[model samples]
Target chain A: MNFEEGKKQFIQTWGKLGSEWGINRTMAQVHALLLIAPKPLSTEEIMEELSISRGNANMNIRDLLGWNLVHKELVPGDRKEYFVAEKDIWEIAKRISRERKRREIEPVKSVLHQLQEVEGDRSKDEVKAFTDMMNQLGGFVDKMDKSVDIMLSSDQSWFFGMLLKLIK
Target chain B: MNFEEGKKQFIQTWGKLGSEWGINRTMAQVHALLLIAPKPLSTEEIMEELSISRGNANMNIRDLLGWNLVHKELVPGDRKEYFVAEKDIWEIAKRISRERKRREIEPVKSVLHQLQEVEGDRSKDEVKAFTDMMNQLGGFVDKMDKSVDIMLSSDQSWFFGMLLKLIK
Candidate 1:
């Protein structure tokens, strides 16, 4: 396929992938456009290209910034803010992992821990089963939490290298 | 919370958490119910508990079965098919990762690989950049693919043990 067609295909695929990763379609499309564009793009350019309203563009861009997936760029003479996505694929994955760990993993782990305090007889099958389930799930999350911490501290080459070795 | 209350809360939370992980709300709820239920539930029971229609319940249950999250059981002397979730959390997680690897990661890697063959002058900035991006993303996916394969082959205790040690 040609350049324009390839670019379009990339954005569409990225959008769908984003939905699977818990990101909304519009935000993913915006990020996809910025990721593929040769340079930083202004909000108007983003809205025009994606056929989105100004409000929609503004909201998704703000959400992207919150996710640390996009950054604000300042044009030399232009007053309007421009935005660009973190193009390095490794960095993008790290940012996503960090945010999800904080948003989803941390809270869930906390709840699982708290459930250990359920006042009940440990000998009862129902009570033991429930507590055991929580403890098992909690333990798994702890390991994962530590693993991601180690991963985020290392560079992509080192992380992938370790993963490759461990997988073998 | 008491056992029943805590169970209800856990189901609700799991359903919401499932949405963030790309499982739709109703399907997740159905899975959550089955996971906590003492025994297999018929389609009518699942529908009544979740307040979902027969078609909706059937479709989601079929989808869950396809994902290996739920299984069909034949109750003695009962004509209706009953369903049970794979209640072991580790097994549940393993099934999800395995399915996602098949449905999303593998196909995405294939496309990214094909994009490398886009016939164009390599010297052009856009062409070179797009090709490079795809290659990097593809490489990350490749590493993840291998990592998952290894994880899937092992039991939960062994896999998580290795992960904890590696991270430490």
Candidate 2:
């Protein structure tokens, strides 16, 4: 494939992948576009390239900035603000994991903890099953919480190296 | 919380978590209902308890079966099919990871590989940046693929034991 074709395919695939992982498609597409751009791009350029409406492009860019995956860049003489993605793939991964942990894992873990304390009759099979499942789920969520914490805090090479060794 | 309140909260939380991870709300809710159920649930029971239409419950149950997360059980004297979720938490995690790897990771990696082969002038900064990004993404995806494979193949206790140790 040529450069243009390759770039289109990448953005499309990235958008689909993002939607599957609970992100909006336009947001992921915006990120994909910025990821390969030679320099920071103005919002209008992003809208034109992606064939997205101004509002759609602007909303996603703002959300991306909130996630710390993208940043604002000011050109020396231009009045318009430009955006750039965090080009370091490892940093991108860490940011996403940290955000997901905070948004999904933390809330779920909190609920799981509360559910585990349900007042019930232990001898009853219904109560027994519910409590047991809560305990199991709570334990699993705790492990996941710890795992994300370690991933966020550790150096990329050292963390992946040890993980790869253990997996092997 | 009382048992009923706890059950309601758990289902709501699980459904929210599922939607955040790209699963539909009702499907996740159905799965949540099964997770804490003391006995295999009939379609009618599920619909009534969740206040969902019969079609909705049936569809999600079918999907859960497709994901290998739920199974249909036939009671000796009853003609109606009963459904049960895989009660083992570790097994559930492995199944989800495996499915996601097949659905998301494999396809993205394929596209990344194709994008990496884009014919371009190496001297062009745009081409150079795109190729470099694709290569970096490909490497990370490969590592993730291997990690999932290891998780799938290893015994639960052994895998978690080693992983927890490494994280510490």
Candidate 3:
């Protein structure tokens, strides 16, 4: 396949993957574009290459910046801001894992803790059984979250390999 | 916390986690409810507990079923379908892995393969680079998926322990 067609297909596929993971398509497409670019690209360049609206280009760039996946670049004697993505796939995975843990896991842990205090009919066997099970599940998630936290703290593959050993 | 407050917190947190991972809020809440229920719940019961519209409940329930995370149960002398989540959390995780592989990863891989055929100068370079990276990623995910499949297929803890040893 030719360069332009191949680039377009890559962007489309990456964008679809992003949407399935709960991110907007344009954001993923912009990331894909930045991933393959040889140098930092200006917003205008991104807009032209992706055939996206100015607002979309601007918004997604900001979101990527917030995720620490993309960054603003200053060009000598250039007025327009340029952007680039983190080139290392491993670093990208770390950032994603940290963000997910912070945004999703921690909050869920807090709620699960609160739920454990519910004084629902302790005398009733069913209610007791349900709460007991919920407690067990909550404890399980909490342990997993701790393991994820440990994994996120380092770039050590051996640590994860060890944890994987413990799963059974 | 009181029962009402605790339940509310649980639902809200579960919904937030779901959204971050690409599942909708209602779908996650329904799953969470099923996780804690002592018995299989009828659709009407789920609607009442969650205070969601019938259509919304039906749609999310169907999604959960498609993921194989929820099962339909036949009640004696009852026409209304009952639902229950797989009680094993590990099993639930394995099902999610398989479903996501089918629904998301496979499609992305197919497109990546197609993109490799695109011809052109810079575009070909871009396509080759993107497809190469995706292929590597696909392999990683495929291995982890296979591990999950094997883990769920039997009650053998020693094999899982061995796989975790490999990961570590």
Candidate 4:
């Protein structure tokens, strides 16, 4: 396949993958487009390239910025804002890992903590078992939370370098 | 709050969390229900509890079974097939991580592998940069794949035990 064809296929496939994981299709597609693009693209250019409505394009771009996946760039002497994705693959992975931990893991952990304090009679089997389950699950997630915290705070190259060695 | 109230809130909130991560709302809800239920639940019980249609309940339960999060229990003297979630949080988590690696990461890695083999003028800057990005991304994902494989093959407690120590 030609470069353009391969690029298009990649973007589409990536977007579908994103949707399966819970991200909106448009947002993933926009990120995919930015990933393959050789240079920064403007809102207008993004809309035109993706053949999406202005509102859809704008919203997804804003969300991308919120996730730290994309950033605004100023072309020399041009007032128009151009958007560029963090092209470093490692950085992309880091941003995603950190953001997801913040968005998904942290909130769930908070709820688990609260649920652990549920006022109840511990004598009854039903109540005892339920609370015990919650505590066990809570502890499991707590461990995972710590693991994610370590991952987010550490530098990728050194961390993964040592990790690959240890795991291997 | 009472056990019932807390359980209800937990299930709802957990389902929302799953949605953000790319699992559909209903499937997550079903899993949540099974998670909190003290005993195995039959199709009728699940449907009534969730107030969902039979098809919806069955489909989601089947999906949960597929994901290794839920299992069938054959009760003595009961013809109905009852389902119980893998209430052990560690096992549930391991299943999810392993399944996601197979479903999402592996496919993307394969595509990246193929894209790296794109036949083109290697001397051109465009071709070079694009291929380099793919390679870098592919390499990073491969490292992740290896990490996941290790996690899957090893005992959860031992793996997490060693990992927590290493990360610390």
Tens-place lDDT digits, model 1, residues A47-130 = 999999999999999999999999999988889999988988888888999999999989888877776557677787667767
RMSD of 3: 3.6
TM-score for every candidate vs. truth?
Answer: 0.93, 0.97, 0.85, 0.94
DockQ value of candidate 2: 0.77
Q: Candidate 1 clashing pairs?
A: none
Candidate 1 i-RMS (Å)?
2.0
RMSD (Å) of each candidate, 1 decimal: 2.0, 1.2, 3.6, 1.8
Ten-residue segment with the worst summed lDDT in candidate 4 chain B? B159-168
Q: Is candidate 3 or candidate 4 better by lDDT?
A: 4
Residue-level lDDT tens digits of model 2 in B35-148: 999899999999999999999999999999989999999999999999999999999999999999998999999989889899989899999999999999999899888888
- Angstrom error of the Cα, residue A4, model 1: value is 1.1
Q: Sorted by lDDT, highest first, which candidate order results?
A: 2, 4, 1, 3
DockQ of the candidate models in sequence: 0.54, 0.77, 0.46, 0.57
Clashing pairs in 2: none
Q: Which sections of candidate 3 miss by over 4 Å?
A: A153-168, B113-168
Ranked candidates (DockQ, high to low): 2, 4, 1, 3
TM-score of 1: 0.93
Candidate 4 per-residue lDDT, tens place, B1-168, comes to 778888787888888998998887888988888887778999999898889999999899888888999999999998999999888877787899989998888889899888877877878766776677778878888988888777777776786686588655
On a 0 to 1 DockQ scale, where is model 1? 0.54
For candidate 3, lDDT tens digit of each residue in A1-168? 666666777788889899899989899999999987767999999999988889989999999998999999999999999998897765787787788778777777777776777887888765675578668767767756765665566554554455345444
Task: For candidate 3, give the DockQ.
Answer: 0.46
Interface RMSD for all numbered candidates:
2.0, 1.3, 4.4, 2.0
CAPRI class assigned to model 1: medium
